[model samples]
Target: MIEIESVTKSYGDVRVLDDVSLTIPTGGITSLVGANGAGKSTLLSVAARLVPADGGRVRVDGMDVATAPGPVLARRLGVLRQENAMSVRLTVRELVAFGRFPHSGGRLTAEDHRLVDEAMAWFELGPLADRHLDQLSGGQRQRAYVAMVMCQGTDHVLLDEPLNNLDMRHAVQMMRMLRGMADELGRTVVLVVHDVNVASCYSDRIVAMREGRLVAEGPTAELMTPELLRKVFDVEVEVHELAGRRIGVPWS
Candidate 1:
């Protein structure tokens, strides 16, 4: 489990995360949703140690993120942040192979190659394996990055705005794949998603943030209420039961 206790972060005078505390258990898909500047991304960064917290602590499966060794932590947690910029051009296969660096130390063994191949296959990136990132569409590039994370094979995976460039079809496919990572592979998957309906439809739990605080969090059914939506988003939303799935629609 990822245990966050009284976590806080600030930029000069402005507090981004104010005494935030949350626990994400192992082996399920959890979605973080809220308006912009709600600290969803910041919190994930703090948890993954991509950003340092001002106070408090984050622990991953009894390992403290603050003091853990870089290589040791890298092997346990894999994070895919919003901004991925590369100065040099690299093929999709080459980019994905980088995920094995922590395990392989840049010398890919036969097992590392096998894992890379499996990740490419999982994201359906075999067709574009040789293409550079700039050559592929936004959706395709996003999938390639995700495949890289998948190849990392960490027990806990954190992705921020994974559906940003995906079409509806690809968005659904990404959500399905995230769910599969948890259910089929027994990995803990946490993501920051803007689409509440997508989170409701696919995530086991929904954690909502507001003004740098955790305002609401629970199972999908409990988090889909119009009252909670109004509180978190300052807009009304309606929940519908369709095909045994709880979906949220904008209130008319």
Candidate 2:
């Protein structure tokens, strides 16, 4: 479980997260949705320990993120940031193997290699394993990054804008894959996303943020109403129930 208490971030005079407190339970998909600059990505970054919060505390499974040892935290938590700078000319397989560094310390064992192979296959990157990062399409590169994150095999996975470059089919596939990981492997998946429909369909819980503060949070069904949409995104969206799932229809 991830526990965030009174988390706040700021850049001089500009505050990005304002006394935000949230609890993400273990073993399910939780999607963070909001407009741009809503602090969704910043919140995820703080939870993942990639960035420090100016105030409050974040703990993963009982370990304080602010003081946990790097390897200890990396072994239990994996984060995929929205901006992946690919200045190095590494192959996809090499990139995935990097996920094992916390465990292997740069010396990969046979088991580590097997796990990397499994992650590549899981993300459908086996065919592109030898390709350079710059040589792949945006969606392919995104999948490569996701595969690396999953290869860490951590109890918690934090993803920011994972569906950014994916096509419709790939986006659906990614969500289903994440669902399977949560249901079958009991991994806690936290994602920052813009698509309300995708969040409604895949997340067990939805967290709504606006203007750097969390406005609402609950089970997806309760959070997917038209009223919340208006409050969070400032748009009226009709929610239709089909086959026990809430489908959000944005007003055009």
Candidate 3:
């Protein structure tokens, strides 16, 4: 479990996260959903230790993320930021291998190589393993980056805007893969997503934030109501039940 207690952050005079506290349970897909500037990405960054919070603390499992050793924390928590840009040129395979750094310290043993290969095959990137990152399409590159995070073999995976550059097909594919990771692999997946319908379809839990505050959070079924959607997004949403799932339509 990830415990965030009274977490706060600010940029100059603008406060992004205001005494935000959320607990993400062990295994399942938990999506942080809200409007732009709702501090969804900022909260994720604070939990992952990518951004230092101005106040409060975060703990993963039982270890304090603020004081844990770098390798120890990296081995337990894996993060994929929204903007992934490699400074140097690297092949798909090479980039995936970087996930093993915490375990192998740059010297990939047989086991590390095996896991890297498995991750590539899992994401259907085997054919493009030798291809450079720049050679692949946006969706393909996103898949490769996710594969790297999964290859890290961590218990918790936090992704910020995993569907950013993908088209409709790729976006669905990415959500399905993430759902599989939670259901099949039993890895805890937490992500920041803009599409509430997508979250309603794939996520087990939803954490809704607005204006740097957590508006609501609960199981997908419990939180998908039109009333709650209105409170979170400040827009009148018509929720319809489709194939045993509640989908929010803001246009209605």
Candidate 4:
């Protein structure tokens, strides 16, 4: 479990995350939904120790995120940021191998190589494994990046906008893959998502944030409502139950 105690972050005079506190459960998919500048990325970066919180602390499974050793924390947690700008000219396989550095320390054993290959295969990157990132399409590159993160073999995975730039088919495929990761591999997946309907249909829990604070957090059916949608996104939406799933249709 990831425990956050009064985590706060700021940029000069502007506070991005206000005295926020929340516990992310051990397994299953949890989606973070919020509008632009709602502190979603900031919170994920703080949790992953990519950014320092101005106040409070974050703990992953018992180790303090701020003080934990880099390799130790990397072995237990993997984070995919919103932007991945790689300057080096590296093949997809080489990029995914970087995730094993914590365990392999730049020396990949047979087992490490096997894991990397498995991740590449899991994300359907077998054909693109030798291709460089710049050579692939946006969706293909996204899948390669996701494979890299999965190659970390961490119990906790944090993805900021995993579905960015993906078409409907790819988006649905990614969601299904995440579900399999949680249900089959028992990994805890948390993602910052823009589409509330996707959040409603896939996530086990939905965390709604606004103005740097968490406004609501609960099961999809309970937390997803017309009033909640209006309050969170400031848009009137219709909620429907189709095929035992709660979906939202924003009123345009």
Give the worst 10-residue stretch by lDDT in candidate 1.
243-252
Quote the positional error of residue 121 for candidate 1 in Å: 0.1
- What are the TM-scores, per candidate, against the unseen true structure? 0.98, 0.98, 0.98, 0.98
Cα shift from native, residue 209, model 3 (Å): 0.3
Kindly report which residue stretches of model 4 are placed more than 4 angstroms away from their true locations once superposed. none
Poorly placed runs, candidate 3 (over 4 Å): none
- For candidate 4, write residues 15-84 as lDDT tens digits: 9999889999999999999889889999999999999999999999999999999999999999999899
When sorted by lDDT, best at the front, the candidate numbers are 3, 2, 4, 1
Q: How many clashing residue pairs, candidate 1?
A: 0
RMSD values for the candidates in order, in angstroms, are: 0.9, 0.9, 0.8, 0.8
lDDT (0-100) at residue 175 of candidate 3? Answer: 93
lDDT for each of the candidates?
0.92, 0.94, 0.95, 0.93
Report the Cα lDDT for residue 245, model 1.
84
lDDT of candidate 4 at residue 45, scale 0 to 100? 96
Model 3: per-residue lDDT, tens digit, 35-86? Answer: 9999999999999999999999999988888899989999999999999987
Q: Please report the TM-score between candidate 1 and the true structure.
A: 0.98
